[model samples]
Target chain A: MKIAIIQFGGSNCDMDVLHIFKDILNVNAELVWYKNKDLSGYDGVVLPGGFSYGDYLRSGAIASRTPIMDSVKKIANEGKPVLGICNGFQILTEASLLDGALMTNSYPKFICDWTYLKVENNNTIFTSRFNEGEVIKIPVAHKEGNYYNTPERLNELNNNHQVAFRYVNQKGHLTNESNPNGSVENIAGITNSKGNVLGLMPHPERAAESILGSKDGLKLFLSMVDYFSNE
Target chain B: MEYYAEVTVQLKDGMLDPEGSTIKRALEHLGYSPKDVKSAKKFIITIESESIDKAKDTVDEMCRRLIANPVIHDYSIIMREA
Candidate 1:
């Protein structure tokens, strides 16, 4: 399947995402500049991580208003799969593609390290490869990764099974210590109401290759491939 | 005539307050009572308009579209004729 990795100004992980799609998954992928409006040819879109707009006026605040985001919204509305990683997740929140806002970490520090993520809902196209409650290791790096949603909205997300991942301890138990940013309910990733769009504060592209220390993140990409291939 | 509009945006209750908590800690260290203190942001805009209604409309639009994220932040706009 052809995947489009969106490249916005200051997007640092676009190349890494592209390489994972091309070199690892052997899928047809291309980098789509943020100014491009046409996304008709691509089956899926990936918003990779980085300090978009240098994180000047809040993380992802300025990048969310880029011209290409209109097309991104259109594609997402069409039920095509879309994944936002790290700063891309922040942009998705800023763009209202997903619910809730990512705020400063409760600890007030930028955290960067491999974090254990529990797969909360594996039925979605993004996490179908993993079983529910299974823990996966991925790297998270962000200062504003704490997810904040109203109690009513959080309840709705829980009822709809929209929560995708939760930080977990090494023993596979969910704990506060596992939460890198003190996100609500230890949430690390979530999906839109339609379940077609997902946003996670982890750097899956950074761990797609075993040579990079681990290949656990490859399953996420492979799961997306399986999703489109089955359609 | 010149009019001033005050817009205050605050996070909804029950939402985590990392920034506010940080300030509270700093204030506590300074030997001040910072308990139950919540932080908010405000924007004061001065505009030249013919009528108060026109100024209110303009500032309301700004608050709705730019100053606040309706999903998380609630804002109040107050106008004062200058």
Candidate 2:
């Protein structure tokens, strides 16, 4: 499956994401800068993690207004898969591609640590390889990762099963200690109403290899490849 | 004419204010009353314009587009008429 990763001016993870797709997954992947509007050939697109525009106004606030996001939004509306990680998640929120917004962490400090995430909804293409309630360890590094949504939207996410991941303890049980950024209901990731777009705060690319600590993140990338291969 | 505008943006009440909480603690340590202190960002902009309406519109646009993320921040503009 061919994948296109969007790279904005301040994007730092485009290379890492491309490397994993090329070397590890052995999939055809290319880095498309923010200025490029052509994305007709790729099977999927990824908004990789980084402090786009230095997180000056707010994380992903500036990057969302870049010219390429318009096309990304168009591609997403067509039922293609779009995965956003870290600041990419923030960008999705800013662009209104995903529901809710990410606020500063309750801790009020930059948090950089390994976090355990529970697979809340494995039925989606992004988590099809994992079982429901499965615990996966991934690294999270961000100052503004706290997710917030209105009451109606939160209920909608629950009823629609749009929540993809939640913070969990080492025993795979949801707990406050495992809530790295104080996200409401310990939410760590969510999908759009159509389930075609995914936004997650953790860095799955950072954990794609066992050398980085765990290979659990590989399942996500593999799931995407598997999904596109079947199509 | 040169007009100076100061924009102050703050988190709405009932929202978690980690930065304000941190600053409040620091003030308490400094032996100030520190009863209630909220933190907000201030932006000072100087614009040359021919009319007040034009300057206000331009600064308002800047606030919405760059100075603040409307999702979280509420900003008030204070313009100094020259």
Candidate 3:
């Protein structure tokens, strides 16, 4: 399946995503520059991490206005799987493709570490590889990964099962300290109402190999592969 | 006529502002009893317009379209002749 990795100016994780998908997963993935608006050939799309538009005004705020995002939105609307990681998550929210904004971390520092994620909903295309409530380790690197949404909206998201992942301890218990960012409800990852567009603060591509300290992330990518092959 | 539009964007009330809170804490540490600190962004844009009323409408539109995120931010626009 052909996958397009949208690359905006200052998007550093574009290469890493391409390498993981092309070299590791053997998926036909190409990096599409921000100005190239056409995205018809790609079956799936990924907006990986990095300080897009130099994180000016806000993380992903300026990048979201780039030309290529219009095509990305169209693909997402067509029910194609669109995954946004780190700054990519910020861009998705900024573009209104996803709900809520990622704010500065509560501690007010950039955090870079491995954290445990609990699979809150395994029924979606993005999390179907893992069982519900399963714990997986992934790396998170961002200054503004804290997710914020109105309390009413958070409840709505929960009722719809749009919340796909939540922060948890190694033992799989959700606690205040387990949350690296002060995101309400410890949200680590979430999906669109249609269950196609997925956004998360962690770098799943960085965790695709066991040599990188965790292989848990590969399952999610493999799940994407499974999702397209079945379609 | 040249009109200057100044836009101030702030987080919606009741939303948490970590950066603002951090600043509040720092002030408290320095013996200031500031109960809260809310941060906002200001953008000034100069444009040609036929009238002040027309400029006001245009700047308001700009706020909705680009200067503010309606979901999390509330923005106000002020227009003045330049």
On TM-score, the leading prediction is 3
Per-prediction TM-score, chain B alone: 0.81, 0.83, 0.94
Tens digits of per-residue lDDT for model 3, A26-67: 989999988889999999899989998889888999988888
Per-prediction DockQ, in order?
A: 0.53, 0.57, 0.68
Please report the candidate that would top lDDT against the real structure: 3
How do the residues A1-231 of candidate 1 rate in per-residue lDDT, one tens digit apiece? Answer: 788899888999999998999988889999998888888888889999999989864688788888788888998999999999999999999999999989889898998899998899999999888888888889999999999888899999999999999999987898888888989999999999899999999888888888888787898999999998899
Cα lDDT tens digits, model 2, A97-128, are 99988999999889999999999999887999
Pairs that collide, model 1: none
Report the TM-score measured on chain A for model 1: 0.98
Sorting all predicted structures by TM-score, with the top scorer first, yields 3, 2, 1
Candidate 3: residue A18 Cα off by (Å): 0.8
The total number of steric clashes, by the backbone 3 Å criterion, in model 1 comes to 0
lDDT of 1 at A142: 92
Candidate 1, residues B24-62, lDDT tens digits: the string is 888999999955767788889999999989999999998
Best-to-worst DockQ order: 3, 2, 1
Best by DockQ: 3
- Overall local distance difference test of candidate 1: 0.89
Which portions of model 3 miss their true places by more than 4 Å?
none
